[model samples]
Target chain A: MPDATEGSATRREELLAIAAGLFAEKGFKNTTVRDIADASGILSGSLYHHFDSKESMVDEILRTFQEELFGQYDAILASDAGPLDQLEQAVVVSFEAIDKHRDEVAIFQNEAAHLLTFERFGYLAERNEQSRDVWLTLLRNGIEAGVLRDDLDVELTYRFIRDTVWVAVSWYRPGGRRTHTEIARQYLSILLEGIHCA
Target chain B: MPDATEGSATRREELLAIAAGLFAEKGFKNTTVRDIADASGILSGSLYHHFDSKESMVDEILRTFQEELFGQYDAILASDAGPLDQLEQAVVVSFEAIDKHRDEVAIFQNEAAHLLTFERFGYLAERNEQSRDVWLTLLRNGIEAGVLRDDLDVELTYRFIRDTVWVAVSWYRPGGRRTHTEIARQYLSILLEGIHCA
Candidate 1:
């Protein structure tokens, strides 16, 4: 049996997941604490015991997801793989995150801009820069290594790849016909070679 | 010096532009005709003088934008350019539209899913299919021409390119230091050869 603090933490995690689903389906501004409470079948008072406010719950949610995501990115960056290999690993890992954390990804993508205005969510911007740095580092290394094309524009190229990979969260469903690995393979194929029929 | 009907049409255009900006900013479901009229500094009654309702205004805005955009697409499709050149032309034309019709593009990007529930906006889905066909045709032609890599997954490749190109509307500003053509050139370089230095 779980102790009181453990049970409380478990309950808190469960409630946050429910709130995230609601926030993702309905815009964060449109979703109320009452809606989340109602969805969780708990009184608003019970929710408050777990979270001081909705903002805190969302803050925790986004922070927790980013922590895990950036940890993976940090590992990829630290790996001794060649620059091109590291870039490929990064893309694959990103698709895997979308598959494994679709709801959290959706909520963050939809809400980050609106949420980041508050002082509590300043880390979102930092994570954005961190993500850019990870990609930019890999790209610059690839250029120096000659594995990637010399003529590519690093900043615009980063945005293209970043946007292309993350926007899939809007439509990608886990356990669908294509697994994350399959999607990553196709994406990398198109990225490496122009889609023309040589 | 404007005739009454011409003046009315000009007023209608201005109102539609205002409505598009609001719809893009606040979302269509959250925006009301009253909000639009208020933003335009006119009474709701005067708004109706130009537009029957907010629905009519949105319909007209979307219809006109789509007509013009599709006309350009059709011209590109029917042109005598090779597959690779056609692909480049299509990308340039798309960025041009993003530059010239930012508001309409924003509205379509943000509201197409929500708006498609109504009968009047069914063409949004059709337009999506039409867009897929346009890219697929170009991709297939490229394959037959032996200019592109044959191992690519054309459908996934099309989605990748489409998402990368269209999502720029979210962040792109027309008067930014980089012109749309420069952005297009940067994108073209990455799309063709990728971002490795060697």
Candidate 2:
């Protein structure tokens, strides 16, 4: 049998998952602690045992998600792979995030702007800058290595890549007809080779 | 001196512009007729002299914007331009829309899903289908003409194009450093020719 502490930890995680889903579907500002507790089939008082407030729940959710995502980016950046390979890996990792953490990705996309206004969420703004830096570094390296087009506007290119990949979360269903891998493959093809026929 | 009717018409247009900006900024659901009246520096009763309700104001705003935008798309589709030219022209027209009607573009992006649930906004859904059909037609024609790659997943390609182009409304400003034409050109270059150096 599982230890009582282990079972409680599992329950806490389950509650966070439920809260994350609600936060993603209903805007974070619109979701209440009671709603999360009700969704979990528990009393609001019981929820307080796991999380102090909805803000705490969301804070935990975003913090955990961003940490894991940035961790992957750091790994890709540190790898000895060529600049082109690193860029491709970065795109693959982003799509994987959308696939595995759909709710978290949506919450970040939809709520980060508003959430960043709070002192507690100041790190989100830094994460945004860090993300820009990652792409710019990959792009500049690619251009320097003579893999990416020399004439490309790095900023615009980064924005296009960023927008195209993340916005897929809006329409991309996890188990839908096209798997995220396939979607990433196709996007990479378009990004690496012109859609125009030779 | 302008006739009273012409003066009222200009004021009506000004009020709708203010309402659109608020709806874009605060979200359509959060914006109230009183807020619009306040923004216009007029009494709510005086505001209602032009529009029956907030819904009416939004309806007119969306209707006018979509009609003008879709009208341009129709012209491009009906033109004798080749499929490749047509695709490029369609993209150019879309960025132009973002530049010219930033508030309307944002309001539509942020509110269309919520607004579509109402009976009055039924046409928004149809407009969505029409947009899909427009892009698919362009892609199909390009494929048939041997200009675009035949192996492309037309639906996915369309989504990428649509997402990247329209999502620019989030960051695009009317008088930004780059003109809409320049942004469209760079985007088209990336879309048509892969960012990879030949």
lDDT scores in order: 0.83, 0.90
Docking class of 2: medium
Clash count per candidate: 10, 1
Q: On residues B114-196, what C-alpha lDDT tens digit does candidate 1 reach at each position?
A: 67878989998999899999889988888788877777777787888888888888788989978999998788766776453
| Model 1 chain A worst lDDT window (10 residues) | A1-10
In order, what fnat does every candidate score?
0.60, 0.80
Q: What is the lDDT of residue B19 in candidate 2?
A: 96
Off by over 4 Å in 1: A1-9, A30-38, A42-49, A52-54, B1-9, B29-38, B43-57, B118-120, B196-198
C-alpha lDDT of residue B164 in model 2: 95
Best by TM-score: 2
lDDT of 2 by residue, B1-198 (tens): 545456455777889999999988777766778898898898878986888888988888998999999999999999999999999999999999999999999888877866787899999999999999999999999999999998879999999999999999988887778999999999999999999987
Per-candidate TM-score, chain A: 0.93, 0.93
Pairs in steric clash, model 1: A142-B197, A143-B197, A146-B198, A148-B196, A149-B196, A196-B148, A196-B149, A197-B143, A197-B148, A198-B148
